[model samples]
Target: MRQLLQRLNNNSLYVIISLLIFGKGLGFCLNRKFFFYPPQFAWLMNNVFLDYSMMIAGIGLLVYVCLPSNNNFVLGVLLAIITVLLAIITCIEIEHVIFAGEIEFVQNAISNSAIIGFILWTARHYSKR
Candidate 1:
């Protein structure tokens, strides 16, 4: 039963990550029309090439970690990178809020925080098993 729960948890994590990748891809393709945040946040979404690169990097790391003969050290490094990226993104949103004096992107900031929380939780959960 313990092993079965672990397997289910791992599969669900992958599904969540896969959905994030798909959503990022769709937003990249749609540009400003994606409308997750606002027009101000549109710049981040509009850069399709950069978005694609970041998304690919993340997914590639996940794939490498999930391979049959994967190295645990590499997986740990990937998780660290993911955590740092989430932190950087959250910081950027905070910086924007500080400089622009606009509360419009508050929702974006909160959403980034949630993503960071999710990533951190997943990292901790997987590290335990």
Candidate 2:
């Protein structure tokens, strides 16, 4: 397990996770009805603007992860934006748990938190280069 983890570098992990997020964002934008929203989150049920914003943020995260780290300023700005967006999403997931009393929302909350951690790890790796 340790060897497998050692082989998975930060950038590769970031790209893989970003692709998953991109897929989720695409699904959110293209088929909002497919997702199950608790009554408390009714505002998220058919919010096209939020859906597109998520997709755009996913795209931005993908681009940020893939781009060369030649310029720290651009990468830092992107990282900040991505971090804020992800934090917001994670907060919403936590809110769902609080408002709806659903334990399942914890999975999404944890996943988003992990993604944020990976993003920060990747950023740290790049900054060290």
Candidate 3:
């Protein structure tokens, strides 16, 4: 059990993923009554943008954990690229989702965010050294 736990903590991708997910989940739990989104930002934080952000964050988590040991640069590059993609996609999709009145994106976003949370937790269980 100790050995298994040690292996998980050494994974950086897992740590990032966990934090991102925790961040997203925090948002949802804080605004449970608002099933869709806040009225003040109806033009922003649309379902599409939210989903896209979650996806990008998810991708970041994947690349962080998937890169080879000698490919730290590659892993970092991938994470950066995916994060940018997520941000860009979210910005563009926000207006569209708002106009269309579709809010299903939150569902996908939350699901993916939860996945990141678990991966992050597992990663943190391993050895840091």
Candidate 4:
């Protein structure tokens, strides 16, 4: 059961992240025609900024996991934790978006993607060590 759960965790996480990013993209695409409001625009802008930041961090994480560096497992783990926390906080802000028009799908996508990416990256890198 534990092993099965671990396996599913990555898959589900991936789905969640895809959904979140998709939602955000959809929101940006539809903001003008569908949800034309200042708050919505601001939310989308904030979401984009946050995602860009996360993308940079995500790249660093990729390098950290893929490279044969020294014992940076602690740092790697910390980064993953931080990403998870960001996802949670982002989700709250996105909840309002969803209430307005189900744009929170992007949050789910972002969170799931980050979670799965970090977990698999860490597991593969560490297990090899």
Which of the numbered candidates is closest to the native, going by highest lDDT?
Answer: 2
TM-score of each: 0.62, 0.67, 0.34, 0.42
Model 2, poorest ten-residue lDDT window?
A: 2-11
lDDT of 1 by residue, 1-129 (tens): 675555446556744654564465556456645333455766763566655654765676555544544466766676566556556656766766776665666787898678777867776675423
Q: RMSD, model 3, all Cα superposed?
A: 10.0
Task: Arrange candidates by lDDT, descending.
Answer: 2, 1, 3, 4
On residues 63-107, what C-alpha lDDT tens digit does candidate 3 reach at each position?
Answer: 445443445455445455445544444543453356656566555
**Which prediction has the highest TM-score against the true structure?**
2
Q: Global lDDT for candidate 1? A: 0.60
Regions more than 4 Å wrong, model 4: 1-48, 72-74, 85-94, 101-128
**lDDT for 83 (candidate 3):** 50
lDDT of 2 by residue, 39-93 (tens): 5566765576665666666677556655544467766676666677678778877
Cα distance off (Å), candidate 2, residue 85:
1.6
RMSD of each: 5.2, 6.2, 10.0, 9.1
Model 4 Cα lDDT, one tens digit per residue, 1-129: 674454435334333433444444445444444332346465554455555445545444444434444455654563555456455545654664566565745666575556556655644553323
TM-score, prediction 1: 0.62
Model 1, residue 2: what's the lDDT?
Answer: 71
